[model samples]
Target: MNETYDKRIMKQKTHRLLEAIAALIISAIIALIFSFLVSVLSSSQVYAQRVAGREGLYRDSVYRRVIGQGSTSLSCYLSYPQGGSSVLRGYGHNAYELGKLGEFIRAALSDTLIYVRSVRVCGYCSVDGNYTSNEQLARKRSLGFMQFILSEYPFLRRYGIRADWVGEDWDQLRSLVASSTLNERDEILQIIDRVDIFSGREKLLMDLNGGAPYRMMEQLFFPLLRRVELTVEYDLHRIIEERYRRKLNDREFALLLEQEREKVRREERLLAEQRALKEKWQADSLAVEETARAQQARAQQAGAQESARRADEAAAAAYRRRREAAREASAARTEHRKLYPLWGVKTNLYALAGLTPQGERTTFMPNLEIEYFAFGRWSLSASALYAYWDFAQGEFWGVTSYTLEPRFWFSPTGLCRGLYTGLYARTGDFDIRRSVVEGVPTDNRTGTYYEAGASLGYVLPLSRHWYLEAGVSGGYRRVADKVYDVEQDKHYLVRNQSQSRLRLTDIRLNIGYRLGKKTIK
Candidate 1:
């Protein structure tokens, strides 16, 4: 019972204390309102009269503000550190460029002719992280950057300021990869074109070629991606007409310091505003000049980056050319090792010189030819045909021949095989008795012959050691024939006939062999 009574007593005391505090607050509020009304009423008449004249001064100030205008743009880029949402002001031109943006914006706000409409920042993040986290990071980065701007210029903390965001900028990555001369650019693009969103694409990149390509991209391109763009848009005040233009005089300027009528005071105020606008214009010019300098610097940096990229591309192209040249050189060496012969010997298999004895019937004639390939495309050869065989009495017929030829091959390694042309000179001695002319047995004819001709032939390689060659020679052939009447006498020369003709000298189908190694040139 005593505790309940004590609680009721404390509650009543608490209510009385609350009533007293409320009454004090109401009294202070009424007193403040009464003082505000008294001051406003007392100054209302003079304030209205001064404001009426000040409207014209305001128009004049606006005109001064509009004249000699300069640039009013504030565009800049801000970058963030790798994988972090916070901005790095000192990072990669962010400090200098963002400084220019702030200077222009702060100056624009104070200028009379410009009204800042919006301050916008667009944020982007690289694809190094997950999509959801990157999206949130983009928003946070943009908001954080705007907050930094606002904190720097607290007057900009007004209503209607916003920031937009773009997360995991894959399109930017694709464009960078396309324009870059990366060694694995194709593989990177393939994964980007074919991989799924928020899937194992990043994983594949993390594991590609021991992560070398991914690391390269991260080092070179991702820094550009982790950035934000700031744009400050504004509207300009209209140009005040000529009639509103007037200069402030010395009297008016002096009257600005002394007590005078409202008109003189208004002129003084107008002069002050005009001076303010002129100063603001000067400040704006400086900002514009500074911004232009920054832009020129940025352009130089971009040019340097472009030069570096092109240098890398040229290096890659040179490397590829060297690789191709190396392969071609290896092939050339292998083919050079196949050059087989320096000295060669061959026997003509066809019975050409043996069975095809000219102007006489020879018993047998076998020929041997030896060649020394001086160069792969050139050779010198000597040939001899000496066969003297008699099977019956009083039927002795034989031919002896010697030939020297210098050959030119159609190919670089034609010593072992291919087509060739040669100029040959030959001298031979022969004696024969049985002859046939136009399908009828005629008188015996014997001859000593001299020949000079060009020969063409193709050599087909049967092995590294052996080849099959076929050729025929045609040129001037001279045969000194000792003519004898067949019915008259066996060993009697009836008459001497001089024989000179342009005809086939010899035909050869040779089985040839190559020996010894050639010195490589």
Candidate 2:
């Protein structure tokens, strides 16, 4: 009997070994296939370098000539310097030209979106003629030009273009001078070979050296190289999609209409207030003037009336006080200027309640959240959460977890005030312990899980920097396989070890403080 049992065990062990090997082989094959697919996809991608070179080369050739033709086809519109020779000499001019360039760009893009990847606009002039230091003149010319474009055109505002006031690469300056002489083009190219602009060590390491510096043809062509070149960058697909989809969101559309109506109402109220104040001030002024006239008449008629002088002083004091009060009220109305046009940060602390081991809802626990604002007023936040529930009758009870969530907040008013609702999906790891089973210590375990839920809340300001917020949030949480154990028998047959899924339903009350400016009315 012993011999037969040993044989059976050996045969089972052999079969188990074969199964393990087969599983390993299958896993390797799948991994290899996945890697192959990734490589193929990566090779087909239009990466930054390729796009830059293709677009840069074409613009250097075509756009330069187009500008030479006097159509301003390759310039960014300027807005800041208003208009001047200074504006014309700097990035300001380039910024102005951008709008015109944009029209051609739009046509070129067709259905595609355009993104300005990068713009380096540098302006240079002969240092000999200017009264200012060459560097100082260059800086002023750069800034003046930038300001001109900024003041003239609002379109360049989209690119977030900023000028370098005192930046110069002397090497490039020399290269510019050298390349300007017709006889020295090839000689300058030879000298530039030792320069690191195009063929740097890092570029060589990456096998991306294009092996040449870009020279503006105008300096080599006609009157002068005294100009600013604005490099416009964009991804055709991205810009097209963005422009096409730019629309008022439902809430924003509604809020805009609401704001217009409110504006009209406020204007009417302001007009009424102004009229009332004006009439009151006018009447008071007339009374004071008449009294003064009467007092002066009396003074001329009979020596002096001290009482009349005192009344005149009191009237002046009252008028000053009234003006001061009006100014204070105006300040209160407009003080909370929106700092960020489209971004806000919020911190929230909530008291949490959870079920106990015995199946009773426990008292409040603590939770906190730090959130980031994303596109379309949506937010993604991470939270540290704790839930403890005790029940009088059930065996399972207790959980403490942390979750990362991508949250979407819908503010019906388009302003994050009053009634706002959010839907959040959270997933993370957690540690939990079951109530001591049979009076023995329960083992502590860990697992990864996910939760989904929605929350409704209202933010009401009680003061400029403080607000009272309350909301009810509920979610379904699923905890998977806290622990798994596999055992192999003497015959090498794998035995079922352990596995379980824990699902918890949570409904909690939360009250929080909003730490920021004036409460939204």
Candidate maximizing TM-score: 1
Candidate 1 lDDT, 221-293, residue by residue in tens: 8877877766655432211211123444556444432332344445456556556655654565455555545
Off by over 4 Å in 2: 1-366, 374-376, 386-400, 404-414, 434-446, 472-476, 482-521
RMSD of 1: 50.2
Span of ten consecutive residues with least summed lDDT in model 2:
48-57
User: How many residue pairs clash in all the candidates, one count each?
Assistant: 0, 52
Per-residue error (Å), model 2, residue 159: 55
Q: Write the per-residue lDDT of candidate 2 for residues 32-91, one digit (tens) a residue.
A: 654663464355322211121112212222323322222222333333342234543344
* Clash pairs for candidate 1: none
The count of residue-pair clashes in candidate 2 stands at: 52
Regions of model 1 farther than 4 Å from truth: 1-337, 357-363, 391-396, 414-416, 435-442, 485-490, 518-521
TM-score of each: 0.33, 0.28
lDDT of 1 at 48: 15
State each model's CA lDDT, in order: 0.64, 0.45
